[model samples]
Target: MKDTIKEKVASAVRSVYGIDASDAIEKASFEPPRKKEFGDVATNAAFILAKVLRRPPLEIARQIAEQLSGEKEFTRIEVAGKGFVNFFLSPRFYEELLKKIVETDFYVSDIGKKKKVLIEYVSANPTGPLHVGHGRGAVVGDVLSRVMALTGYKVDKEFYINDAGRQIKLLGLSIYYRIQELAGRNLTLPDDAYMGEYIVEIAKELMLKYPEIVDMEEEKAIELAAEFGKKVLLEEIKKTLERLKVEFDNWFSEKSLYNDGKVEKVLEFLKEKGLIYEKDGALWLKTSQFGDDKDRVVKRSTGEYTYFASDIAYHYDKILRGYDKGIDIWGADHHGYIPRVKAAIEALGESGDWLEVILIQLVKLFKHGEEVKMSKRAGNFVTLDWLMDEVGVDAVRFFFLTKRHDTPLDFDIDLALSEKSENPVYYVQYAHARISSILDKAKEEGIEPSTEHLNLLREEEFELILKCYGLKSTLESVAKKREPHLLPYYLIELASAFHKYYNKNRVVDTDSPELSSARLYLVSGVRKTIRSGLNILNVNAPGRM
Candidate 1:
């Protein structure tokens, strides 16, 4: 419906001023008026076009309003303050919209135009299990992936494993020391080594599998322990992600960048372009030339490649694979890392904007008005798996998205477990279940949902119908803004509208059978929309609560 209005205004500009306003058309937005009395939808197209057409906004708005006032879908079109054109849609528009909703899935859109997008997220190191912070990024990426795919983007979900580097070495050393201690050998565990109990468990398992590993040479034993520990922890991460309904198409190993010589390949290219130089016996990239605050070291003086080297190679590989865009989900602490990565991409001859980074802020759990800290299983921080077990997959996924990805989220456990409207996930799901019960009861009463008398729907019912139709815009906004949190809020508002309508209206009046069928049909659209939304979030929409 918004698109229809946009196209009409674009046509009006072409017909009125004989100017190609495609750019202005793209910039214009048709949104609901802030006040209910203003109109159903309002557009700032005239204001956007004024700069192009060189006319006063109010004059342009009046012209556009006059051009649109005769459209059959709208009862009136008014020129409001500062060139805003407000459109009052007619009852017939609501009738047709409700009919479209009942007859088909009207919310699906093709805004993405088949763009190839790679969303890499939850790329936590294999040295430990995924913590709550990683869980937050995982949900953001997964939900964004789902929404993009629904809107017609060819999306591939990926996890970039930091399997090569000091972290993995520390994981191995941590396990190796635990093995020695278990074998009654005197040793001091390094402070930097992993302190999680899972490390000790991995060591015990490694010892059972390779009994002589305890007596093996230190370097060799630690190497084996590191590999074994990485495998075990990575398997645990995959299982936890699956339990939370998150899956990835690719698990790209950081080690592969080295094994396949991609890091050297990128360095050679940069060197040939004179973008690489040596300083203090360490190789540096002229990142500052491309907008970085200073040069970045790709190789340390001791000769080990830095993590930035592999990161550059990884992103260069992403571009080589023909992805139109790459999205990386990282912790907010990595904010400073964004410029250098984008600078590397720019130096490599791709637009820096080709890669987008979403920084996920911290997630702190609250129970009984107090902050809940630490997971006994994870040793230092809360684990995603533990949180899921404490509540459920649905609650965890929904609550993670209750806030913007870049903002801090304080998850309230009591509210999530509650069976009240304050619990957003419950409220949305209950709306679905409630609608199902209504339709079933209507069926038992020998009435079937029909769009035959949708015009019988009252003003409140039309408002509910309009809210149901908002799923289209909600998804478009999410895909455009890369904000999945809007989806939960949209569903909540839609559900609220339905619940209010239910409290104030009757749907199964036997004497008014036509009205009953029409109301049931509207109710069915709401159920479909809520279920569709929950499915995108990978949450369950139960028929019974």
Candidate 2:
């Protein structure tokens, strides 16, 4: 749409002053005016070209306006506020948009050329179940992927499993000792051992799968248990995500990268670039040269590669897969990791811009204004599964995305579970269901209004139609900014506008057929918009809630 406006303005400038398109068009900027009275759209072309044309900005704007006099889409074009070209679009423009909305299957406009994008999110360690903090990242990444896909981007949602790290080793040892304790054997669990009942359950599963390993030495038993525990835990994680309405295209494993020699290849590439050097008996990457805080170790003195090294290999694999861009959704606690990862990408001679990181802040759970404590020992952390079972998947997802990704989220359980209409998710869904009910009534009454009769829509109908037209721009801005919170806010505002219109007017009044038909068209458009918004958030838009 911006491109369309730019071309039209450029053509008008070229036709008015006989200036070259390149020079005249290069100076133009299309911006939405701040005030509706100014216009729906505005440009600063006259201000930019005033000096080159040796004329006042208003005079240049006047000449361009004269050249664009017969443009039907724009109702009026005028120079305002020291050379701004303000254009008020004709009501027919909005009518056409409404017709398209009713005729189309989706609400969002097609703005992208369907570029493939891989979004890896909530790649938490599988040693334990996901906490509420991980849930925030999960919902943000999921909703963003949905929004991008809705806007015509081919999105590949992914989860990176860190099953090959020291955490997994600790998990194995924890289960081995817990099994010993359960068997009346004296053994002390290590400090780093996982302290959850799930460990005991995993140990039981391991004993059933491989009874021969139960009698082996502790070290060997731990090694076997770690491998088995990782698989079981990962399965549970997948189940939890599925319950939350989240799924991934791929589950990339860190251990697979090691088995395939991808880590070695990434290190060799850095070595070839002179970015890796051995210092103090440890292999270090010169990340400081690439704007990192300090040089980081790729391999520690203990001969074990650091997690950062594995990350570099993982990202290298992503680039090798031929994706134009890669995105990682992580918790805010890992904010310090961004610069080093970007430095690694740069050191590898790839553009750092291709790697994007979205940091989701912590989620603080509250019940009646008091903090809800999480106990790892009792397995009482607010897991995503528990949240879904309590308030349902739709409410959980909608609440998670109600705030900016970077802002701290407070999940009030009492408020979310309330039966009142104050809950925003319920409110939005209710509005949609109400509109659906009205449409159903219309359909049953044999009063099907065709698109031709939609031309009789009134002022409130046009206002709602204009709001629908802004969805394209709103979605574009939200996706480009990696912000999904805007969608929920827009949904609430749109619902409020609809409810206000609903309270003031009667949709099925038998006296005036024109008004009734117009109201029906407006209601149909609102229903589509509501469903589209809910779909992007992974929430349900029910016919009856």
Candidate 3:
């Protein structure tokens, strides 16, 4: 639709000025005007052409508007401001769009162009339960995968388990020492050890299974403890994510890179390519040569590989798997980690653009205008499971995306639990339910939705149609910008439009059968569009509050 408008403006420019404005036309943009009174859509082609035509922008705009005045799809084309042409779409145009939306699945788009994409997110270490921070990334990645797949991209979701590092060793030690304490050994846990109560629980479970673990060698017992702790925590992580309705297609383990010898192999490959060097008794990668701030050590002086080494191997594995793109969703604190990873990719003869990282900031939960800081369950941090139990999976998933992922979000617990319109998720869901009731009441009166009398749709009905038509564009924007917040905002706006329309219009009036039928069709489109938007976000569209 936007392309059609751009072509019409280009043709108008050619016909009126007797000159091809192809180059300037490329700079033109058709977007919604700032104010509703301005029009439905506006173009800045005249501003782009003023430089080429050596005329005032206002003069060019007036000429273009006059040329496009007779367009069938536009009710009026008026020159606004100094050089903007605002187009008021005809009612018939919206009527046709609404009819199509009612009769078809019209929200899908080809914006992704069928590219194979791998989205890895919420790769939290398997040492403990997932916190709210992980929950935020989980929702972002999950929704993005859905949006990308709907937009013609073949996407696979992944969770990278960071189970092969100092953290895992510490987790094992934490549990091993707890078991020793259970066996009546006077052992004091180190300050760096995992102190959560869940650690003791894991130790208790392991103790029941391995009664002789206390007598085993320290190194061997720690390994056994680590394996048990990892398995138990990983299963809990999966269950928690499932509780929130977030599922991944793959659970890639960082340990697998070492088990498969890929980590050592990558280092050797880089060494052969002259990208690795020895310095200060450590093996370092020449990351600075590929846009990093400085060289990075892949292997420490203690003969242990850093996490960066495994990450490089993992991403190289992703490239070897033939994905067109790999998106990593990391915590916002890992902002500096991006350049180094991209550097690793470039050092390996791949374009830095092959890898994209989305940084998810922290989520601060609030209740009754006060920050709720502690969670008794996770010891120091709030767990995703506890939050879901407090509110619901729908609120957790929906609220996580209420703001831009890169920005910190202050989630209001009271608002989430509220049943009023102040709650965004509730408001949108209520719109779906309200429309369902309207349609049900219409059906009871034998006034079925019909597109035959769509011409009878008035200004408010056309306005609702235009809002419903925005679903496709919203999904496209979410896929392109990687911003899932736009979908929720779009849903809120659509619901608000519907609510306002419902408050003013009577859809099941017996005196006006034709108008009632036309309005019912519009109402049905709103319901379908709302349900579709909510479904993409993995939120429910309830038929009743």
Candidate 4:
């Protein structure tokens, strides 16, 4: 619809001023008016073309309006203050929108062709259960993938496991010491050993599984415990993600890179390209040359590669999978690491534009107006599963994605759990349920109102229908900006409009059959919008509270 408006205005501007298409279309921008009375849609075409045409903006706007006098979609086009083109959409257009919503299962728009894009997110180390910090990234990445999919992108959601890093080693050792301590054996634990209580439970399971190897050599014990620990942690991660309703298309392992010689192959490729140099018994990647703060060590003096080297190899593997673009959703702490990763990709002869790193900031949790801090070392951190138990997956996902990914979020548990008016999620859901109730009542009364009768809608009914019509535009904006948070905000506004309309009018008034039919069409449109928004966020919009 917006595209139609832009095209019609472009043609009008070109014909009215006897200008070329390029000159007239270059300055066209379609925006919604702040005040509805001004018009439904407004444009700044005249303001942009005023200088080129050597005419006053108002004069140009008037000329464009005169040319667009009888357009079908628009009721009237007027030159407003300072040459703005204010367009009032015909009521029939919105009525048609309502009819379209009920007639189709999906909204129609030119969502670009499907491009293979890999999204790597929540690649949290498998050293322990996922905490709240990991939850934020999981939610963001999942919703981002969904939104991109809605925009007609072939999205592959993945979890890159850091199963071969030092963290996993520490986890193994943590389990080892815990097992020895439970057996009444004296052992000193490393400072970096995981202190969570789940470590002890894992140790107990390991001890039970490997009774014969309880007194084995340290190396054998570490190896056995690390294997067991990794299995348990992976299971926990799977469970947490399942509870959160986040499903990944793949779970890529860092260890796989080593097992397949991909890491060595990547290093060799860098060396062949003169991007790696041996200096002072260490292999270094000249990342500074590609805009890094300084050169980074790929291989240390001990002849083992750093974590960054493994990461580079893993990313290279993603590119080799034939994806048109790659996206890594990391936490804010890894923000500084983006530059070097991009540099490595550039050095590997790949366009940096193909690699996008979305950094989600921290999420601060609050309960009853008090801050809740979760620390891994303290072993008191709130796991993702705990959050799901506190608030259902719907609320958790919605709250996590209620802001821009780059901005820090404050998740108030009490607010989310509130069934009262303070909870926006509840409010939105209530609106959906209310519409469902109205539809049920209509069916119960045996009133089979056809959507084609929406043409009899009034100004208020059309206003609600217009809101539904803007869904495609809202979704396009969210996808283009990579901001899934906008969906929740828009849903809230939509619910408010519906609730206001419902409170002011009755939908099932038998005397006014025309109004009743129009209201039913509006109800169907609202329900469709709510369902679409919730699906994008991976939430369930229940028909009942």
Which candidate comes out best when scored by TM-score? 1
Please tell me which model should have the higher TM-score, number 1 or number 3: 1
- Candidates sorted by TM-score, descending order? 1, 2, 4, 3
* Cα deviation of 376, candidate 3, in Å: 2.6
After the best TM-score superposition of candidate 3, give how far the Cα of residue 204 lies from its true spot, in angstroms: 1.3
Give the alpha-carbon lDDT of every model.
0.92, 0.82, 0.92, 0.83
- lDDT tens digits by residue: candidate 4, 1-545: 56667777678767876657554554478878999888888988887787688889889888888888787777988888889989898977776667776667445344646889998999888888898879889988888787788778888999988899678878888898998999899899887788878898999988888985578898789888998899888988999898898899999999999999999999999999999999999999989988889999999999888999998998898888999899899889998899999989888888878899888898888998998876444386878877787888889988887788899899999999999767888988888888888899898886656665666778888778768767777777776677778888889889999989989988887887766877787788889988888877778888888
Taking all chains together, the TM-score of candidate 2 against the true structure is: 0.92
Candidate 3 whole-model C-alpha lDDT, 0 to 1: 0.92
lDDT, candidate 1, equals: 0.92
Model 2: weakest 10-residue lDDT segment is 104-113
* Per-prediction TM-score: 0.95, 0.92, 0.91, 0.91
Residue-wise C-alpha lDDT for candidate 1, range 58-113, written one tens digit per residue: 99999888887888889999988889999998988888888777677787888899
- State how far residue 116 of model 2 sits from its true place (Å): 4.3
Off by over 4 Å in 2: 1-36, 45-60, 105-116, 375-380, 444-446
Q: Clashes per prediction?
A: 0, 0, 0, 0
lDDT of 3 by residue, 120-195 (tens): 9999999999999999999999999999999999999999999999999999999999999989999989999987
Q: Tell me each candidate's RMSD, in Å, in order.
A: 2.1, 2.9, 3.3, 3.1
